[model samples]
Target: MPEGTPELSAKDLRTLIPEYEGLALATTLLNPEPGEPGVRESSLGGPLLWPADEPWPYCAQEDHWTFGSDLRNTTEIVAGTVPTVPILQLFARDVPGLEFPEGKDLLQVVWCALNHEHDPGPVMPLLYWRNEAEVVAGGLLSEIPVAGEGEYDEDHMPEPSTLSPTPTDDYPSRHDLPEDVRDTWEPRFRSPTSGGVMWPSDSNVIATKAGGWPAWIQPADWPDCDGGHRMEHLLTITGDIQLGDCGGVYFFHCRRCPGLPWDWRFDCH
Candidate 1:
């Protein structure tokens, strides 16, 4: 368990509700605090260790725009492409338990810092698994494109922060519990110390974490990969960044297939 975090034992959970047995999953809580981080370090909204030769990703979606109206008529908006900004950079050394593709030790996530109408997430979020040594050997991209002031949505652009990853056991949220378990447990095993709050409410951690079930605000919508295999939750972006209406962005990947296909979803308060 992470220090200073509330204790929630799986054994106690199972004793109260047997159906919860073996439901605990390994997860890493990425506690982010605002700071400047080096390119090689694990961080949120930090500079990426990107290869110099690789073309940077840009969102071509013409519908994206900031919440403010003044900058909406700019030439860049008229051109219809916006540069994607780094949202997260995770190193294997910080999250050793996280599964990585063969020879890959880093995970970098980028998304257009603009809002897309009628979409669940950022205009186009991109994930990359890379070898740290290979990126270093090939030379790093010294110049990265930054979204000009007023061109980016401040809500989606997280301030650069360093990460302190803490590995712990995570359990499903109340929403993810089976109907039978909810029915049987809620009535018979209410916690005396919790006031009126239920056990699951105290147990689940809702923050930027890797692995485990999503901190879903609504019903869970676990997506399947192209190969039909259920994807596993890879990351959750919340608590540290303010998405639309204080929502969370979730990332998932399928390990059963090659290339590790991934997807994302957004949920708000």
Candidate 2:
């Protein structure tokens, strides 16, 4: 490193994350009750058994639902489904002038939001702008924005750090079903109806709940934000990993998923 040697711009960092075709992700909002348990409601002068295991009411909006009772006592359950583009809509509408930059990609934005990195120093640029010119290095790439580069430099090339070939099961795997998956959900705020979770609950804590069955389920081919989603079970995919880097993501699922016994694939994308 030298005094005038330019540093990697935010645009440069953005190039690291290669978005595969399926590199997309969404937030699961509700885990509505599936199959017949004890809830048998047929409503309006009829029975009350949930007419063939329908999803919970407002389950589609589970992302913003306020909790009332426990799963056993309540008649329905819900979570959120945060599709990327729609999720962006939510962020844009809430932000003043939608003036947020350096955090755009859903997973990265969600991670920053979750980790409380409101004042992004390094990651802001990478995730915020896809195009290089719009980045913080906008016009200052070689103008020297920092002075610490020379401080860490050495007279000659330093030897590469080495690790022992001996391996251990220190973090052999990443399997844990996390409950503390925190999220920021507002009250009854309405907008252009972005696709997410909404239900009646005390907190807008965003995370996944038991999907009823241990296997998998998909409610309908074309799911709407309604009763249809609740009936669907938790569709899962698993694998293993060292780190999950997106626009800038840090899914704690590595610790939260193992406990639940997911296949845990090494490569999610």
Candidate 3:
């Protein structure tokens, strides 16, 4: 509904699976210049409004998918900017009609320092914050200080020369789409090439219908809910959120359970 090609119409999809429910699709392409407005309520390619009291998040796990000498480079890039790494926050509350667990609000945070690295190493760094207030106060209401110069760790600072070249092709179109794909969708739907919804129309299967980019629906990676049922596909933050070639950030949640804490995962292809 946010303006993109849908893989299947609700009527057509229901014909295939009568029990199919709908999904809300949102897509955003970020601008990477310094000093620009980086934070927005439900968009990607923006800065995160992190509390000044919180330390900048670092990949502490030694076995992280993208760990090694490149870690330093990634760290440096994140810290290179005057105001820490750009963070994108997706809140379930802001997503109209999203049926999240009761008494809890879900927020998925993603940050990647190296958007253009040939190999972004491992999965991009991610954080999940679950606010348990009935009214969902604080972070949403309070005016907090954002991370700025001298706030981040100095040791991880990057040298001016090592930063990845500024991304010139902010949003590249998919020229390699197969004839079948090209024929099935319109030009506007096929181009822009990245970020869109892959709604779940077949039981637990998520079908890619919007942008040519596909959403990865990995049940094994889905976080379990207290209701004893697997989480459902909420939506995906697709496009170049700096995770490397055509990476997508997927979000899942349990409709029956309340505040199971962690419910999101990231993957790229």
Sliding window of 10 residues with minimal summed lDDT for model 1: 1-10
The residue ranges of model 1 lying beyond 4 angstroms of the native Cα positions read: 1-15, 69-76, 186-199
**Any runs in candidate 3 off by more than 4 Å, and if so which?**
1-40, 63-84, 91-94, 99-108, 112-124, 130-214, 217-228, 240-242, 245-247, 255-259, 263-268
lDDT of 3: 0.38
Cα lDDT tens digits, model 1, 187-219, are 565445653435465456788988877888777
Model 3 steric clash total: 7
* lDDT, candidates in the order shown: 0.81, 0.19, 0.38
Model 3 quality (TM-score): 0.43
The CA lDDT at 229 in model 1 is 94
Per-residue lDDT over 57-174 for candidate 2, one digit per residue giving the tens place of the 0 to 100 score: 2112332211133523322223332111100101222212222234431111111111112322111111111222233233322321111221111111111111111111110000
The global Cα lDDT (0 to 1) of model 2 is 0.19
Give per-model TM-scores: 0.87, 0.14, 0.43
User: Which residues of candidate 2, in runs, are more than 4 Å off?
Assistant: 1-130, 133-138, 145-172, 175-269
Q: Which prediction has the highest TM-score against the true structure?
A: 1
**Per-residue lDDT tens digits of candidate 3, residues 1-269?**
24563555445534543322222223222222333442334334344545434555553333222223555643333323323343444445444344445444544454433332343322344655554343233343244334444333322222111111111111112222234543553432332434453332322213211111225533235567766786755544443233344345555656565554335555545
Q: Evaluate residue 188 in candidate 3 and report its C-alpha lDDT on the 0 to 100 scale.
A: 29
